[model samples]
Target: MRVFDAKLKLQSQLRLMRSENNTIGMVPTMGALHEGHLALVRQALSENDVVVVSIFINPTQFNNPEDLNKYPRSMEQDSKLLSELSEELLIFAPGIREMYPESVESVSYNFDGIEEVMEGKHRPGHFDGVATIVEALLRAVSPDRAYFGEKDYQQLQIVRKLVSQKQLPIEIMGCPIVREPSGLAMSSRNERLPKRLRKEASFIYKTLQAAKVKFGTESAIEVSDWVDNEFNIHPDLELEYFEIADAETLRPIRRKQKENKYRAFIAVYAEGIRLIDNIALN
Candidate 1:
């Protein structure tokens, strides 16, 4: 597989692909490859003739400095995993300087109305940076399709808006959220969790499931309280924010919006490892 770290080379490769009208798929990742990341690669492999994986940890997306510092990176190991997937897949692993060649004076996004709740409110400039980099990537690769994990459902949604608003020629595809046998969502940050706490982390999903079960029958307030109570069982966990929101808008549901399926999204801190999970609220 060809590896291009510089924009010039990547553009050259892309132009050549465009010339031949080759169908290319992209799996954008922040490295620290896990089964979830590989599942995206698997989907790409199955769909497109060429798969280009970008492994750049975009710094601007991170709201917390500590979180950025602790974000996992295993370049050698990740490269090996991708190679095992196939020698046909090309990897674009670039550094911050290369990706952001110009002084980015500002980066923000009007995510319709979805940016006000859950992740957007919690991590202020996160989705903006997410849009910035992913936008740059889509422009760079100009792939027929791009694969994203459904774990970050909100982010995936924003990417779709980007393609529509910006008029980019790319299909935003969301693959399933890969989980472990114990039901813990497979995440790169899972590597940072203390081994013991790792097993306990599965409760996030359990609590979200409980919230899903309680959704329409009870008030959003009651469901949130129940989630908080379930979380209290784990001393190591710190409740950041929990809410059942309109899945598309990411706003707190005041009444039953039967027209749209709502989602219960939660973020919690346990042993300094932040984890997020969501389930559809029927």
Candidate 2:
């Protein structure tokens, strides 16, 4: 595996690959790799001649300072795990200094309302930072295909928009969300959960499952209320938001929704760490 920290050198090498008609796949990650990340890497390996994984914990994406301070980081362990997966894998491990040599300001392309709701509303400039770093990474890697897990469904959609609008010559593909057999979605943040709470964490998925079952019969408001009540039953779980929104736009449904289709997005604080999951209801 070849690793490069400098953006120029990585871009130069990537250009050579494109020149030679080698298919390139990019998997952008925040490090502290988990099954969710490995799933993306494996997908990239299957479809492209070369797989490139980026490990940069972007600081600008964090709206909460304390959460930023607490996010996991294990470079050697992450690299070791990736090494065994694909011998031809390329790693872009740029330091904050290397990534952002200037001020924290980012010249970003926004999706207007799309960038201002759900995860965006909760995290403030979180997605803006995400968009910025992603644009940088996409430009640097310039992969023929980029893979993202549906675990971050909204973010993946936004990236698809970015790629489409920017005409960046990249295909943004959303892989299935990897989950533990118990139903809890796999996440790097899962490591922060206390063991006991980790087990209780599966309840989040169960609640969503119940919500999904209501589908055509229940009103959006009704299903949302049930999810809220389910979280109420588990007082240990701090409910952030349980909402039904437009799948493409991520906007809440104030009244009845047409096409009777929407996405169920939920975020809760379990064991002091926030876990998010979503399902599509049609």
Candidate that scores best on lDDT? 2
Give the runs in model 1 whose Cα sits over 4 Å from its true position. 104-106
Report the alpha-carbon TM-score of model 1 versus the true structure.
0.95
lDDT of 2 by residue, 1-282 (tens): 989999989888888887888899999999999888998999999999988999999989988888889998899999999999987899999998887888775655578578888898888888889888999899878888999998788898889888888889898988998998889999988888888888889999888888888866878888888877888888679999988888877888866666656888988998669999998777
Candidate 1 lDDT tens digits, 197-249: 88888888878877777885888888888888877777878889898888777
* lDDT score for residue 12 of model 1: 88
TM-score of each model, paired residue for residue: 0.95, 0.96
Q: Rate the local accuracy (lDDT) of all candidates.
A: 0.86, 0.87
Scanning candidate 2 in windows of ten residues, the lowest lDDT window is: 254-263
